[model samples]
Target: MEFLWTSFEIVGTIAFAISGALVGVSRRMDIFGMLVLALATAIGGGIVRDILVGHFPPNSLQTGFYVLLTLAVTIAVFMVYRSKQDHHMSTRWVRRIYLTADTIGLASFTVTGTSVGVYAYPQYPIFCMILGILTAVGGGMIRDVLAQRVPSVLREEVYALPAIIGSAVYYVFGYDGAWLYASYGSFITVFLIRTAAIRYEWSLPRVY
Candidate 1:
C-alpha cells in the first residue's frame, strides 16, 4: 500500500511538473520561472493538503526528493523547448500534450489525496472525497492564477467532475481491502473522462 501510494505521488509530481513547464515555455518564461511554475503545480496541492490535515511543515518540505525531482524535470523541459525553438509546433499539438500531462496528474493526485484522507478520517467519506477533488485541482488552480488565466476549475470545461467521480470511486473501493483495484480504477476513471472531455469538447453549461 505504501509503495503504491509513493508511486502515485511520484507520477503525479512528474506529470504536474511537466504540464507546468509546458505552460511556462508557451509563455516564454525563463528557466527560473519555469522551475517556480513547475514546483507550484507539482507540489502546491500536497502542501495545502498537509496544512489542512495538520501535518505541519508538509511532507514535501520535509523531504528534498520532490524538489530535486521537480528541478530535474523542469530543466529537462527547458532544454527540450530550447532545442526545439526552430521547429514550428502547432498549438493543437501543444495543447494535446498539456492536456495529457494534466489529466495524469489529476488522476494520480486524486488517488493519493483520497487515500490519505480516508486513512486519516475513515469515518468521513464525504470529507475524503472533497479532499481528493481539492487535491486534484489545487495545484492546477495555483498554476493558472500564476499564469494570469482563469482557473480551469471555474471554466466551462468538464474538469472537476472527473475528479469528483474518481474520488468517489476511490473512497468506495479503497476501504474494501482492494487498494490496487481502487487506485487503478480511480485513475482510469479520471483519465478516461478527462481525455474524453478534451477529445469531444465537452463543457458544463455556462450561466452567462
Candidate 2:
C-alpha cells in the first residue's frame, strides 16, 4: 500500500507539472520560465502538506529524483506542445489537454494526500482531510497567483468542493478495511464530478 501510494504521488506530480507547463506555453513563457512554473506547481503542494504535518525537509526535497522528474516532464511537454503549434493544432485542442491534465493531477494528488494523512496520522482525520484538499489544490493556487489570475478553486464550478468531499470520503472509508479501494474510489468520484461539472457548466449557487 505504501508503494502504491508513492507511485500515485510521483505520477500525480508529473501530471501536475505537465499541466503547469501547458499553462506556461499558453502564456508564451520562455523555456526557463515554463520549467520554473512546472517545478513550483509539481512540488508546492507536497511541500505545504509536509510542513503542515511537521514533516521537515519534505519528501519532495529529500527525493532529488522528484525534482529531476518534474524537470524532465516539463521539458517533454513543452517540446511536444511547441512542435505541435507549428503543425497548426487548434487552440481548443491545446486547452482541452491542459484542462484534462489539470483535472487528473487534482484528483490524484487529493487521493495521495488524504491517504498519507489517513495512514500516518489517523487520529486527526479532519486535519488530514484539510491537508489533502490543500495538497491537491495548493499548487494550482500558487500557479494562479504567480500568473496573476484568479485561482480556479475559488470559483463555483464544483472544483475544490470535489477535493474536500473526496478527502472526507477517503477518511471515512479508510478507517475500515480496503484502504486502497476507498481512496481510489474517492479520487475517481472527485475526478468524475469535476469533469462533469466542466462539461455541463455546473456551478454552486452563490447566496450573495
Candidate 3:
C-alpha cells in the first residue's frame, strides 16, 4: 500500500510538472522560470502536507530523487513538444493536456494526501479531507501564482469540489478496497465535470 501510494505520488508529480513546464513555455518564460514552475507544481503540495503534519524538512526535500524526477520530466516534455514543430499547438491541444494532467494529478494527490492523513492522524476525517484537497490543488495554486493567473481550483467548475468528494469517498471506503476503482472513479468524475464546465464556459457569478 505504501509503495502504491508513493508510485501514484511520483506519477502525479511528473504529470503536473510537465503541465507546469508547458505553461511556462507557452508564456515565453525563461529556462529558470520554467524550472521554478516545474518544481513548484511538482512538489508544493507535498511540502505543504509535510509541514501540516509536522514533518520537518519535508519528504520532498529529503529525497533528491523527487527533484531530479521533476526536472527530467520537465525537460523531456519540453523536448518532445519542441521537436514536434509541425504539430500545431492549438488552444485545444493545450487545453486537452492541461485538463488531463490536472485530472490525474488531482486524483493521485487526493489519495496520497488522504492516506497520509489517515496514517498519521487517523482521528480527523475533516482534516484528512482538507489535506486531500490541499494536496490535490496546492501545486496548481503555486503554479498559477507564479504565472500571474487565477488558480483554476478557485474558479467555479467543480475543481476542488471533486477533491472533496473523492476524499470523502476514500474515507468511507478505506484503503483496503480496490485502488483502481476509487482513483479512476474520482478522476472520471472530476474530468467530466471540468470538461462540461469548459464546454459551457461556466463561471461563478461575481460578487460585489
Candidate 4:
C-alpha cells in the first residue's frame, strides 16, 4: 500500500506538471511564468493539504525532487511547443493531451490524499473525503486564479464532482476494508467520469 501511494504521488506530480506547462505554453507565457504555473499545479494541493493537517512547512517544500521535476517538464514543454509551432501544430492536440494527463493527475492525487487523510483522521471520514477532493482540484483552482481565469471547479459541471465522488468511494472502501486496492478503484472512477465529461461535454444547468 505504501509503495502504491508513493508511486501515485510521483506520477501525479509529473502529470500535473505536464498539464500545467501545457496551459502555460498555450497562453504564451515566458519560461519563468510557465515554471511557476507548473510548480503550483504540480504541488500546490499537496502543500495546502499538509498545512491544513498541521504538517509544518509541508513535506513537498522539504524536498527538491518535485521542484526539479516540474522545472524539467516545463522546460521540455517550452522547447517542444515552441519548436512545433512553426509546423502549425494544432492546439486541439495539445488540449487532448492536457485533458488526458490532467485527468490522471486529478484521480491519482485524490486517491492518495484520501488515503493519507484516512490514516491521519481515522475517525473523521468526512474530513478525509474533503481533503481528498481538495487535494485533487485545489491546484487547478490556484492555477486558474493565477492565470486570471475562472476556476474550472466553479464552472465545470463534473470537474470537482468527480473528485468528490472518488473521495467518497475511497472512504467507503477504506472504512469497510472491501479491497486492498481501494485507492486504485477510486482513481478509476474519477478518471472515467472526467473522461466522460470531456467527451460528452457534460455541464451543470445554468442559472438564469
Candidate 5:
C-alpha cells in the first residue's frame, strides 16, 4: 500500500509539473516563474489534501523530495520549450501535450487522493469522494488562476466529472484488502474518461 501510494504521488507530481511548465511557457514566463508554477501545480493539491486530513504543515512542505522533483521537471520543460520556442510550434501539438499531461496528472492524483481519504476516514465515503475530487482539480485551478485564465473545472469541458466518477469507483471498491486493485482501477477509469472526453470534445450544457 505504501509503495503504491508513493508511486502514484510521484507520477502525479511529474505529470502536473509538466502541465504547469507548459502553461508557464504559454504565458511567456521566465525560468523562475516557470519553476514557481510547476511546483504549485505539482503539490498544491497534495498540500490541500494534507490540510484536510489534519496533517499539519503538509507533507510537501516537510520534505524537499517533491519540490526537488518538480524543479527538475520544470527545468527540463523549460529547456525543451525554450528550444522549440525559437521555431514556430504547432498549436495542435502543444495542445496535445498539455492535454495528455493534464489528463495523466488528473488521473494519478485522483487515485492517490481517494486512497488517502479512504485510509484516513473510511467511515465517511462522501468526504473521501470530495477529497478525491478536490485533490485532482485543485492544482489545475491554481495553475489556471496564476495564468490569469478560467479554471478547466469551471469550463464547459468534462474535467471534474472523471475525477468524481473515479473517486466513486475507488470508494466502492477500495474496501477490505482490495486497495491496490481499487487504486489501479480508479486511475485507469479517470484517465480513460478524461482522454475520451478530450477526444470527443465532451462538455456539459452551456447556459449561454
Candidate 6:
C-alpha cells in the first residue's frame, strides 16, 4: 500500500511539473520564474493538504526530493521550449502535449490526494472528497493566478466537476486498502471527463 501510494504521488508530481513548466514556457517566463511556477503547480495542493490535516512542514518540503524533481523537470522543459517556441511550437502537436500532461496530472493527483484523506481522516468521508478535489486542482489554480489568468476551475470548463465526482466516487467505493483498483478507476474517470471536456469544449451553462 505504501509503495503504491508513493508511486501515484510520483507520477502525479512528474505530470504536474511538466504541465506547469509548459505554462511558464508558454508565458515566456524566465528560468527562475518557470521554477517557481512549476513548484506551485506541482506541490501546492499537497502543502495545503498537509497544513489542513495537521501534517506540519508538508511532504513536499520534507526530504527536498519533490523540489529537486520539480526543478529538474522544469529545467528540461525550459531547454526544450526555449529552442522551439519561436520556430515550430504553434503546431497542434504542442497543444495536444500540453493538454495531455495537464489531464494526467489532474487524474494522478486526485487519487493521491484522496488516498491521503482516506488514510488520515477515514471517519469523515466528506473531508476525503474535499481534500481530493482540492489537491487535484489547487496547484493549477495557483499557477493560473500567478500567470494573471482566471483559474480554469472557476471558468466555464467542466474542470472541477470531474475531480469532485471522482473524489466522491472514490470515497464511496474505494478508500479501502483493498481497492487500489478503485483508485485507478477514479483516476481514469477524472482523466477521461477532463480530456473530453477539452476535446469537445464542454462547459457549464453561463448566465450571460
Worst 10 residues of 5 by lDDT: 82-91
C-alpha lDDT score of every prediction, in listed order: 0.90, 0.84, 0.79, 0.86, 0.90, 0.84
Candidate 1 worst ten-residue window by lDDT: 81-90
Show the colliding residue pairs in model 4.
Answer: none
Candidate 3 lDDT, 46-145, residue by residue in tens: 8988889998898888979889998898888777777776656566787688778877787778878877887777678899888888998998899999
Better of 1 and 2 by lDDT: 1
Candidate 3: global Cα-lDDT?
0.79
TM per candidate comes to 0.96, 0.94, 0.87, 0.94, 0.96, 0.93
After TM-score superposition, the amount by which residue 136's alpha carbon in candidate 2 deviates from its true location, in angstroms, is 0.3
Clashes of each: 0, 0, 0, 0, 0, 0
Per-residue alpha-carbon lDDT of candidate 4 for residues 109-132, written as tens digits (9 for 90 to 100): 898788888888979988999899
Which TM-score value belongs to model 1? 0.96
Question: How do the residues 96-142 of candidate 1 rate in per-residue lDDT, one tens digit apiece?
Answer: 78889999999999999898898898789998998889889999999
**Lowest summed lDDT window (length 10), candidate 6:** 82-91
Cα shift from native, residue 183, model 1 (Å):
0.4
Better of 5 and 6 by TM-score: 5
The CA lDDT at 51 in model 1 is 77
Candidate 2 on 1-208: residue-level lDDT in tens? 7787787788789888988887788788998888887877888888889898899899987969889999999889877776664534577887787788888888888988888788778899888789889999999888887877788788546889889988988888886757788678878988998889999999777888
